[model samples]
Target: MDCIAMYIDGQWVESDSGNVTDIVNPANGRVIAQATRGTAADVDNAVAAAKRAFAPGSAWRTLTADDRAALMVKAADLIEARAEKLAVAETNSMGRVYRETRYDDVYAASGAFRYYASLVHELQGKASAENGDMMTVTVREPLGVCAVIAPWNYSMGTTAAGMAPALAAGNPVVVKPSSLAPVATAMMFEALAEAGFPAGSVNLVLGSGGEVGSALAAHPDVAKITFTGGTETGRDIIGRSATSVKRYSMELGGKSPFIMFDDADLDVAVDRLMFGIFLSQGQVCIAGSRLLVQQGVAERVLDMLKERVPKIRIGMPLDPDTEFGPMVSKRHMERVLDYIRLGVEEGARILIGGHRIAEGAFGEGYFVEPTVLVDCTQDMRVVQEEIFGPVLTVQTFADEEEAIRLANGTRYGLAGGVFTSDLGRALRVCSGVNTGIMWANAYLEDTAGMAVSPHRQSGMSVDGGLDGLLEYTVLKQINLKMTPAKSGWFAGME
Candidate 1:
C-alpha cells in the first residue's frame, strides 16, 4: 500500500517521528492507506518555509498578479482534468456519495480556484480627492504567511475555498487538513506544484487538530488563520491564535432554519426542504436542520416528508443508485445516533426513520436512516444545537412573527431559507432572519462569486467573492504631496 505522506516545503516526505495513521475507507471499513501523523516539529518546518517564501525578496513575493493568476488557472485546469480520480478518492475517504462528490465537489473545487484567479487582478484601491493638495491612495498588501485548517467532511472543496483566495492575495499558506480525509487536499497541492507555484508557497501538513493545527495557529510567523469546522474547535483556534493576534476567517457550526409558509408551492418546498437538511447527510455547516412551518401548512409538509424520506437510497458511496451514504466514521455515526436518542428523550416525536443500519450489502459501514422529529419546541436541544447528521427538527408557528422568532432562536446564524409564493412575505421574512445568507423561495442556491458568510456562532468573516480575497490582505494608505509644501505657518514663525 502506498503511504500518504506529508507535503511540506514543496516535497512529500515521511514524518520525522515515523508516526502514521491508517486511512480507512468509511464505506467498507477497509484500511486503504497510511497517512503521515504530523507533529509540532513538522508544523514549525512548514510555517518557516511559508514565511521564507512570503518574505520581501522571495520569488513568490516578486511575482506579478497576472503571473500568479496564470498559475492558478493552470492548477484549476489540472484539477478539472483529474476530476474523476479526485472525486473517487474523496468519496472513499470522506464517506459522501460519489453521485454528489463526482460533480458538485469536484467542480466546486476547480471553480473556486478559477473564481479567485479571476479576481487576482481585481484587488483595487480607492483614491480620495477630498484633500486639495494631497493625493491619498489605498493599497492592498498580502498578510504574509497564513494557516488554512479544513475540516474532513468537505475536505478538498473547503480547502480550496480557503487556499485559492489566500494564494490570489499573494499569501503563502501552510494547510492542515483533518486527519480523517487528507488525500484529495494533498492531491490539490500536487496540482499547484505542477502549475509552477514557488516552493513553499503552498504546503500541506496532515495530522490531528491538537498537534499540527494548534502549532500552526500559534506560530508567530503566521499572520492569519482560515478555518472551517465546529464552533467549539473554532473557539479553541481563536484562543490559541490570540498570542500572535493573528487575523481569523472562520465558517463554524450552524443550525440553520428552513421555513415554509402557507403560500409556498408544496411540491417545490418539499423537494428543496428534503435536500436542504439531508445533503451530505446533513454534515454541512449550512444545513437547514431546523424547520419552522406555518401552522396552516405544517401537517401537509410533514406528510410530504414522511412519504419522501423512505425513497432515499442508503448504500455504499460507490453505488450509482445510492442517495445516502455512510457517515464519515463509526464514531460520528454513533454521535448522530446519540443525538437521535437525546431528541426522543427531550419529548420530540420521531415521525419517521431514526435508527442505525447494521444489515445490508454494506453492513459494516456507518449508516443512519434519514430521521425527522416533529412536535418539537424551539427550546429543545435537538432544535437548538447542531446534530451534524441526517436529523431534522420540525416546529410550527402561528404567525410570521413567531416563525421569525423561532428561526432566529438558535445561537447559530450561518444560513437559512424562507419559502413562499407571496413575494411580500418572503421579502419580509428573509430580512427578519438573522443569518448571513438568506434564500427566498429557494434553498442552497449558490453562485461562483457571491460572498457566503456566517453571522453568529456559525462563524466570522467572509469566505467567498472579493471580500474573501481581501481577508488575506491588509490595507495601507499613502498620502502624497503632489505640489510644493504649504508655508503659511513657517512664514508667520519667520
Candidate 2:
C-alpha cells in the first residue's frame, strides 16, 4: 500500500531512521497505509527549517499581510477542491463516518484557513500620544517557529485550527499529528504547498506522541506550542516546554455535561442529546458524556434513550448511510469497555448497551455498542472521568441547583449544554455551570469567528476568533521622545 512520508521543508521525505508505522482502518482492523515514523532527528531538522523560514527578512517573514492572506485563501480553495479525497483518507484512517469527515471536518478545516485569512489585516495594534512629550505605539509581531500537536479525533480540523492562525500571524509551523490519524493531515499539507506557501513555512511530522510530540514540545527554537489532547499529555507538554519558558495554548480533555430539565421539549432534547454524545462515536473532546436529567423527567428520558440508542446504525466508515463507526483503535475500545465494567461494579445500571459487537463481520473490527448507564451517582468513576468513547452516564438531579452542581462537579470545564424552554431557568443554568462554551436549546453548534477558552483544568489560552490569531503574536511598544534633550534632574547630577 501507499506509504505516506513526512513533509519537511516543502518536500516529502523518509525519516532518517527509515522506519514506518502501519495505518490501520478501525472499521475492519486492516492496514490501509503506512506513515513514516518520525524521530527526534527529523523533528530537529523540521524545527531548524521553520526557524529559518521565520527569520527576519526571510521569504516567508517578509511577505505582506495581504500576500499571506491571498495564499491562505488559495489553500482553502484547493482544500475544498480535494474535499472528497481528504475526507476519504481521514475516514479510512480514523473510522469517523465519511459524511462527517467530508462535510464537517473538511469544511471546518478550510473554513479555519479562510476565517483566519480574513483576519490577517486585523492584527493592527494601537498607538497613543496622550502624554504630549512621548508617543507610544504598540505592534504585534509573529512568534517564531510554532509547533502544533493535534489529536487523532479531528486531525485535519484541529491541525488547521492551530496552523491557520499561526500562519496568518506570520509564523512558520511544525505540525505533529497523532500517529493514529496522520494521512489526511499529510494530504492537507500538500494543498498548502501547491498554494505556494514558502518551503519550510509549513511542515508535517508523523509519529507517536511520546517521541515526536515530546521532541517538539522541548525544542528550544520552538517559540510556542499549541496542543489538543488528553489532560495528562497536556501537562507533560507544559513541563517539557517549561525550561524554555515557551508560550502554549492547550485544548485539553473534557467531560462536558448535557443537562435536561423536566420542562424541556422531550423530542427535541432527545435528538440533541444523541447528537451531542453519539456523534463521531463519542470521540469528541467536548462530547456531552454526562447526562444530568431532572428527577421528574428522568424515567421519560431513559425510556426515550432505550428506544433510540439501538436505532443508531454502526457500519463501515465509508458507507454514507452509517451513523456510527468503530472506535479509533482496539486499545481505546477496550478502555471504554473497562469503564463500562467499572460503572457496573460501582453500582450503576446499564439501561441500553454495554458490550462489544463481536458477531460476524463486526467481530473483525473494534466496535462497541452505544452504551447508556442509569442510576449513576455524581461520584461514580464513569461519571467523574472522561471515557472518550461511545459511553454516556445518566444521573438524576432534584432541581436546578442540583443540576448545576452535578454539571460542575467534574474538574473539566470545557463545554456543556442546557435544555429548557424556560428562558429564565436556561439563563440561570448557563451562567451557573463553569464551562467555557454552553448551548441552550441546541447542541454542537460552533459559529465561525467565535472565541472559546477553557474555564478550569480543561485547558489554557484562547482557541478561536481574534484572540486565537493573537495567540501566535507577541506585543511590543515603541516609545518616541518628542525632545532629544536630557531631563533637568539628570542634568543637575551631571
* 345-397: candidate 1 lDDT, tens digit per residue: 99988998899888865677888889999988877889888899999899998
Model 1 gets an lDDT of 0.89
**Candidate 2: segments with Cα more than 4 A from true spot:** 491-494
Error of 1 at 70 (Å): 0.3
* Ten residues in sequence with the least summed lDDT for candidate 1: 485-494
TM-score against native, each model: 0.97, 0.98
Please report, in order, the local distance difference test score of every candidate based on alpha carbons.
0.89, 0.93
In candidate 1, stretches whose alpha carbon ends up further than 4 angstroms from where it belongs are 129-133, 483-494
- Pick the lDDT winner: 2
How displaced is residue 109 in candidate 1, in Å?
1.0
Give the clash count for each candidate: 0, 0
lDDT of 2 by residue, 1-494 (tens): 67899999989998988789999999899999998899999999999999989888889988999999999999999999999999999999899999899999998999999999999999989999998879999999998999999999999999999999999999999999999999899999989989999989999998999899999998899999999999999999999888797998999989999999999998999999999999999999999999999989988888899899999988888999999999999999999999999999999999888999988888989999999998899889999999999889999889999899899999999999999999999999999999999999999997879999998889999989998899999999999999876666755554
